[model samples]
Target: MKDNKQSEKDSSADNVDEYLQTLGNEDARERRYYSQEQPFSADEMTRLVNEERLNALLAQSDAFLSSLNSEIKDFNDEC
Candidate 1:
């Protein structure tokens, strides 16, 4: 019975490890793909890079705004 339990635990751990490894591989592939996608024009590439950065920044800003709004609501309730 103890051996069966240990085998099950080992199997679960292996599955989790495999999932993490798959994610790592996917990230690496994405990095390689992005790195190779050089636009025909320098300006175009610059624009594309800037757009990605802007989108990431916007997402961060949205998250911050949501947190701030939540905090303000909490403060208002306390008052």
Candidate 2:
């Protein structure tokens, strides 16, 4: 598992190692954004949003939210 993670990390680094291979373009005519073309379809987005693993993050209990809120408030007061 550690080797797999290291391999994945190395692959990501190699992907990003190119010169100006990410984000923007030098030519205004070539410059574009993801907003111009949606990568995922609406159905895909809906499925992703409704995924059990993702939804689990939003399904916090009332007690958890209360504790989190108290901690946030305490931190704010301390600051």
Candidate 3:
């Protein structure tokens, strides 16, 4: 059972790596700022918004993990 959970975690990590790679590729595209400002099509704008939300969520998650680590360290020290 523990091995299954470990494997699932590993797979999720791999998926995250792949997603980051894909995002990097997408972000590398050149923007045509000087051209006529075309309103962002719905799908593209939605994706951008979702990515922004995802980044915010990730930041919160990192902060939460850091807090947990500090609490665990303090607990261990008190033992």
Candidate 4:
């Protein structure tokens, strides 16, 4: 019974090692596929990030202008 328990533990450890190795192999394959198959470029990524930043800035500017206009309107009404 003791020997059987040891064998079971060894088998479980082996299975875990095998599973980890398989996961590593799959991750490597995915990285290779993305590197080879994807059309994404560093320059394009940079451009996209810059565009997003500019868009956010423009939105903030528009909101600020609208709020300032409203405040001016309220002041003119008080006058």
Candidate 5:
């Protein structure tokens, strides 16, 4: 019974060591990838952010205009 428990403990420790090794390998791979030059420059990133903001604003404006148009049509119909 004691031997069985020891064997289980040894197996669990081995599994933990293997899992830690795998994690270390993944971290090294990620570091290598991030160390490379980025695909987008700072200026390009800024432009992309500004363009996204503009698109969001345009979508909001369109929604507001559509709602206003509907309201105006309903008022006209009631008149």
Candidate 6:
């Protein structure tokens, strides 16, 4: 019947409107867009690791050299 078809169309339109309204919800709409992080490549990562290791070794060597200098100075002063 004509009435039954109209009722089905009305219910379908209402469902679509409800779905559209839900799209405005906070959970549905994020505050900001997500970004992907850039990771270093194999060669770049290895270079960074080596650079840090060399820097640490240099610092340790400098500290050892300073300790030896102080000890020599004390011995010379005593002599």
**Alpha-carbon local distance difference test for all models:** 0.94, 0.74, 0.87, 0.94, 0.94, 0.84
Per-residue lDDT over 1-79 for candidate 6, one digit per residue giving the tens place of the 0 to 100 score: 9999999999999999888888766544553333344678999878778787789999999999999999999999999
TM-score of each: 0.51, 0.34, 0.39, 0.47, 0.45, 0.39
Writing each residue's lDDT as its tens digit, candidate 4 over 1-79 gives 9999999999999999999999999999999988898665989878767787789999999999999999999999999
Q: Worst ten-residue run, lDDT, model 1?
A: 38-47
**Model 1 C-alpha lDDT per residue in residues 1-79, reported as the tens digit of each score:** 9999999999999999999999999999999999998647987777667787789999999999999999999999999
Residue pairs in steric clash, candidate 3?
A: none
Give stretches of model 6 more than 4 Å off: 1-49
Is candidate 2 or 4 superior in TM-score? 4
Return the lDDT, model 1, position 12: 100
Model 2: per-residue Cα lDDT over 1-79, one tens digit each: 9999999999888878753454334343354543377588888899778578666766666668989999999999999
Runs of candidate 5 exceeding 4 Å displacement: 38-79
Off by over 4 Å in 1: 41-79
TM-score of model 6 vs. true structure: 0.39
Report RMSD (Å) for each prediction in the order shown: 11.6, 16.0, 20.8, 8.2, 7.4, 14.1
Per TM-score, the best of the predicted structures is 1
Name the candidate, 2 or 5, with the larger TM-score value. Answer: 5
Cα lDDT of model 5 by residue, 1-79, tens digit = 9999999999999999999999999999999988996788888888777787789999999999999999999999999
Query: What tens digits encode model 3's per-residue C-alpha lDDT throughout 13-37?
Result: 9999999998877665434343547
Overall local distance difference test of candidate 2: 0.74
Off by over 4 Å in 4: 38-79
The count of residue-pair clashes in candidate 4 stands at: 0
lDDT at position 46, candidate 6: 80
Which of 1 and 5 is ahead in TM-score? 1
Measured with C-alpha atoms, the lDDT of residue 4 in candidate 1 is 100
